[model samples]
Target: MALGSKKLRVYVWFTLPALLLYIGFFFYPALMGLNYSLTNWDGMARTYRYIGLSNYAAIFKDERFLHALGFTFKYTLIVVVAKLAIALGLALLLTSRMRFRSFFRSIYFFPAVLSLITIGLIFNEIFFTILPVIGEALGIEPLSRNILGNKDTALYGILIANIWHGVAVPMVIFMAGLSSVPKDLHEAATIDGAGKRQRFFSITLPFLIPMLNVNLVLLIKGGLTVFDSIVAMTDGGPGTSTESIGFLIYRHGMLENKFGYATAESIFVFAMIAIISYVQMKWLNKQEVGQQ
Candidate 1:
């Protein structure tokens, strides 16, 4: 008992600092934001009144907010689906018996190491300049124009940039998962006359379920909270068509000084993310169990 107590004391001493920092930085700020969401503070006034739910109520009536919310969901879905598909494809290709596999894996993963803001800026120039010139040369009218300026095509342009930057991490994840798939299983399946597709679906895919869940959850979160890429590329334009909830919060709370209202919107986004994550995790867990 004495030795266990001594070990516990040592562990507490090591953990306490990080635990306190987490509470101070993350937990405390979240609680404070929740409280501020109930008030009418403009972020500058010394005196503020508690407006209790008024800001929350006003969010549903705000057309721009609603538009932003809808656009965010749409953007999230596009990015998540595209990212996963391309990542899985690349992962499968890289894991195959090919020369310079390591080199190609590194090349594919290199973009993930670059800052999203940097990737966004690089792609911004390409979209606005290089692509336009190519489009004109090719006699493609739509490509010749500013894609980021066209409301109909702006989100799709952002989606393209996001997928380019985002696919690397998930590809690396899928590669790791694929590495664990037993060669013996593949050999046995081949001896049994099972084709590649049949073997992949029956054997390799079952082993990749855990990694799939991880990648899905991560991509979903990244899709929903995407702000830096959009900001760097289009700055929520042309005319707020690409504004996500994160950008909305920054615009309202930081730029417009509507701290309370923005906080309410942020809380709404948090709830949305939480609910979606929970549902996805539950569903994915079921799939994992079924595969097992």
Candidate 2:
């Protein structure tokens, strides 16, 4: 079934547009950002000065930026862990031999399909109102101040929103993975005097490793790169306690007109994300291979 030379040529021709599109939209912009990172450009100004490493140095020295970087990392970790655990639980629940399984799946996953900004606002009001109502009815109290407007609680609020919104993705993935596992394995485990927990741990859990790895990588990336939701939810506000690198870059590049410094900041973020994701991906991928 080898393709002829003409067919190969046709395939190459078809791929040309996609390749060009990648170069035009992605690679070119990335290279240009890297180039501008080494200079002091006012984005629109004609004259730009090359100041090697200064932008990078400034990022480290800027206390606010450092704080934001730490917060971003913390946010990524919290959101990923919570999402994984909750998603796995919900997935297991939905995958159990229950009636209206599809209904439950939709109930669990509806939030993940939403635009982040919309979800953020909806939850903001929900937590703001419904929590207070239940609290009053039950002799407790909701958060006194605005959740998203308070520095102490804003990041946590954002973290909760992210988890609530993101749980659906991993839940669906886990459900698919669970369904793909052979029922015979569970049945055999059951016959061997294995408890329900034993059968799950010995059989189903092991088989879900690959899907877990994929979902984890996606979760980590989304947590690290989250921007629109943050902006819509808090604007990294109440004194920048929840400010992330994404918001920092936008504020510098778009708001302050410090394009070069922003570019440098972006490149740093890219490096950090790549390094962390690569390490986690390699580790999880190794585990996946072992399971296989």
Candidate 3:
């Protein structure tokens, strides 16, 4: 009993600092934000009154906010699908017996390590300057214009940059998952006359489902809260066509000083992310169980 008590004390002593920091930095701020969301705080005045749900109610009626929300959903769907497909393909290619496999893996993952803002800025120049020059030279009218400046195609520019910056982690994850798949199973499948596609669907894909879930959750969360790339690239410009929920919150809270309204929007975004992630995780977990 004494030994157990001593161990418990040691554990508590080790964990207490981190626990307090978590509560102070994360939990406390989150609760305060929620409290402020119910108020009419403007973030400048010293005194603010609790308005109770007016800010949330205003969200539905705000056309700009609704448009931003819609754009965010569209962006999330496009990025998640494209990122996963590209990452999985790259992972498979890198994992196969090929020349300079390690070199290719590093090349693919290099963009992920680069700063997203920096990449966005670089791509901004590419989209606005280099592409236009090339397009004019090639006599292609579609590419002749500044892509980031065009409302019709602005979101796609951000999507491409995001995919370039985001695919590395998922690729690495898939590589790890692929590495874990038993070699004997694959060899046996080949011996049994299973072709590449057949072996992939029957053997490889089943093993990768967990990693797929992990990547999907990560990509979805990233897509939902995307901000830095858009800020650096377009600043949600081209008539607010690329404004994500995170950017909307930023504009309200930081730019407009409507902290209460921003917080309300944040709460909605949080709820959305939580619900979507839960559904995906639950569905994926069921698939995992079925596979087992």
Can you write out model 1's per-residue Cα lDDT over 205-269, one digit (the tens) per residue? Answer: 88888889899889888888889988898999989888988999999999999999999999998
- The lDDT values for all models are 0.90, 0.85, 0.92
Q: Assess candidate 3 and give its lDDT.
A: 0.92
Better of 1 and 2 by lDDT: 1
User: What is the Cα-based TM-score of model 1?
Assistant: 0.96
lDDT of 3 by residue, 179-253 (tens): 999899889999999999998888888888899999999999999999999999999988788898899899999
TM-score of each model, paired residue for residue: 0.96, 0.92, 0.97
Candidate 1 vs candidate 2, TM-score winner? 1
Using TM-score as the measure, the top candidate is 3
* Shift of residue 60 alpha carbon in model 1, Å: 1.6
lDDT rank, highest first? Answer: 3, 1, 2
Identify the superior model by TM-score, candidate 1 or candidate 3.
3
Residues 1-292, model 2: lDDT tens digits: 3568889899999999999999999999999999899999988899999998999999999998898889988998899889999999999998788999888888888897799999888877876777667767777544444567668788888887888888988988998999889898778878888998898787888788889888878987887778977887888887788788899899999999999999999999989878987887787776653544
